[model samples]
Target: MNDVMWKRSLALFAVALLLVLGGCGQLTNSSSTASTGTTSNRKVQTTGNYSTTGYNSVVTEGHYKTSAARGVAADYANNALDVKGMETGLMQLSQDVFSPNKYTFQEGQYISAANVKNWLGRKSKSNATGLNPEANGSTDPDKRVPEYLGTMVEQDYMTGSGSKLSLGGISIALGMNAVDYYQKEQYGATFQTKVNKDKQLQEGKTMAQEIVDRLRAKNNVGNVPIFVTIYSLAEQDSLVSGSFIAKATATGKTIDKWDSVDQQSGVLPTVNNQKPINSADATAFNNFKTQVQNFFPNLSGVTASVHYLDGALTQMTVNIQTQFYGQTEIMSFTNYVASVANKLLPGNAPIQIIVSSVNTTQALITRNSGEKEFTTNVLQNY
Candidate 1:
């Protein structure tokens, strides 16, 4: 297809993300049709910045362990970016220990939705598996134990090629609440309890060990390496997603050590310099925005999210908003934006530029990591 007529495809398969957020219902295993001692060898294809090894394709699917949790991510997460960031960041962290080159990927099979529901609940007599502290009879939301732990998502990595793949490692991400929103009464105004970084990390450490132990009790899960990551979710009104604060690896029944993760994400063109930002990235985005806005005077706004890992720029997703309706205007603006992105944006990290009108996406520009040339696609309106 020609550049202007090219229709961009979905960027990431998000198998893990779908499974967690879609309320992975009852699922059938591929082993049902495979011969004994071996499963299928098919590796599901995917696009975007990262790739998976192989996966056990599902025959039939059902709800997420807890259907309520799916909405929790949608309603509680700061925005779509935070939801995507939480899922993608978890996989990236898993790749550090369970090399994607060596291990196959699978949606979590051991931790059921039921397990997650219980673990997310308040410690009470009716439900013994609750992980959150029991609620205190305090009028204040702060005095009552905050539902610090939001959701638990698991991804399994396997070894052995051909048909005989076995679980080698498991990675779990615990989404914690940065701000706890609650109501004093049934119809009362919502109250917010800010969870500091120290509190979030401390609660995450304790929960991580307990979750690791719970998984260890499962069949065929003992002795395998398990990686747990703690993600602090952004507040309801925040534009950017919260970041992963810490991670840990568990071998036996216990988690021996924890490591600090220096990863974070922020929106471009800081609001009154409220949040810290990388000056170089900020400058480049500003220049790119200025050029595109200047070229297309009818543009609405241009914004972006810059992601950093270990203090180095890793990725960026820039969004361009326009009011133009004609295909020619969109095509022209898309090409110009792509040119500006090529000249001014950071070359070391992968970057995605999305141009859209009020209702739909108009074009997509993507540059892979370490590559200079950008692939552009302008969507057709039909």
Candidate 2:
């Protein structure tokens, strides 16, 4: 071939090689493997951002060995949320926050048996029992499994507390807090009706201690710590107001006044117990993102905030904000807080849960629909 012809062929060959290389490496506008970028693995998380963890609720049916067991469950469900029982803490939080009622009783009206079944899940034929004392009145469960119904996902705050005694016999676990005779009289307040809040407080602690003692005697939960926390609105509100509950009761009697401790917000220790469960939980949550950063490094930021009440470490919580890509997801401030909170409590270990995304909520639905949405709240008054 002539020198000129060879030169022309070499130039064309060089141009073809450049085109092939460019096509393989390009990410945009190319129909090749390199162009198909991954969005899942490339999520850039940011703090204070939310991605909407869907609007999912859960209903759990729990069983108790005896009446006293109910009290132990009661405290764990409410005020003493600091206790590290996965079932008691998260489930109670769900019910308390999003309560579901069986039926709406009008002024001067009584609830029907049919309506009661739909509300508390008591087989319409059999007397409504074991669902919720506050829901189905006079229908006490006799060692039967109570049915459970609710949103898809739920949390389990496991405990070594009084598992044997409380989780011993079949004490149907229905998380329905319908307003009934006892519920109407008192509710979650310390001095509901005439019940002395201080005395009731002692009863709960005593019940928990007794229940734990029985569990230990029976060799049920082993060395697992069972911290029972009974709820009385007055006591919790007082703690939030910088006051410590010296003592409270539920027997329709007055309680000793508690002075506010405005300055200290669980900063200093109070309980002389072995480990600082509350403080440890707080610290764990604060540094949670750092712990998970290596696993999912595409993080942009975190979401949520924690609030410190007064004196007691029991009232302390840490709020986390997890941001990814452009989507903002808010799972549960209480969930993360309690998750870390459990780490600090006197339990065998922290709670375990399977978290997921829930994007849809009532607020995001059709605004013009002329329909009333069902509103419910679950309460624990053991």
When superposed on Cα atoms, how far off is each prediction in RMSD?
7.5, 25.8
Assess each prediction's global lDDT (C-alpha) against the native: 0.70, 0.26
Global Cα lDDT for candidate 2: 0.26
Q: Give Cα distance to truth, residue 169, candidate 2, Å.
A: 21
**Regions of candidate 1 where Cα sits further than 4 Å from its true position:** 1-80
Task: Show model 2 residue runs off by greater than 4 Å.
Answer: 1-196, 220-230, 233-306, 309-382
What is candidate 2's TM-score against the reference?
0.22
Instruction: Put down candidate 1 lDDT per residue, 1-382, tens digits, no spaces.
Output: 2322111111121222233324432122422222223345443221111312123322112212222344444444544556667766887788888885566566677777677778888889988988888888775855767888876667777676435667799998888888888788999899877788899999989989999888888998868999999998877656667788899899888889899999978776666555656887888888888888777878667777788989988778777767787998888878888888899988878787777765677787888677778889998978
lDDT per residue for candidate 2 within 1-382, as digits (tens), equals: 3445333333332233234323431111212111111223432111110011111111112211112233333342322222222222223232322221211001100122232334333334554332322223422342222222110111212211211112111101222211111232445422222224454344334433433344344333344322233332222222221112221111112222322222222321222342433565545544654554444454332221122224322222211212322222222232333344344322322121111112111011000112132111111212
Whose lDDT is greatest here? 1
**Candidate 1, run of 10 with poorest lDDT:** 5-14
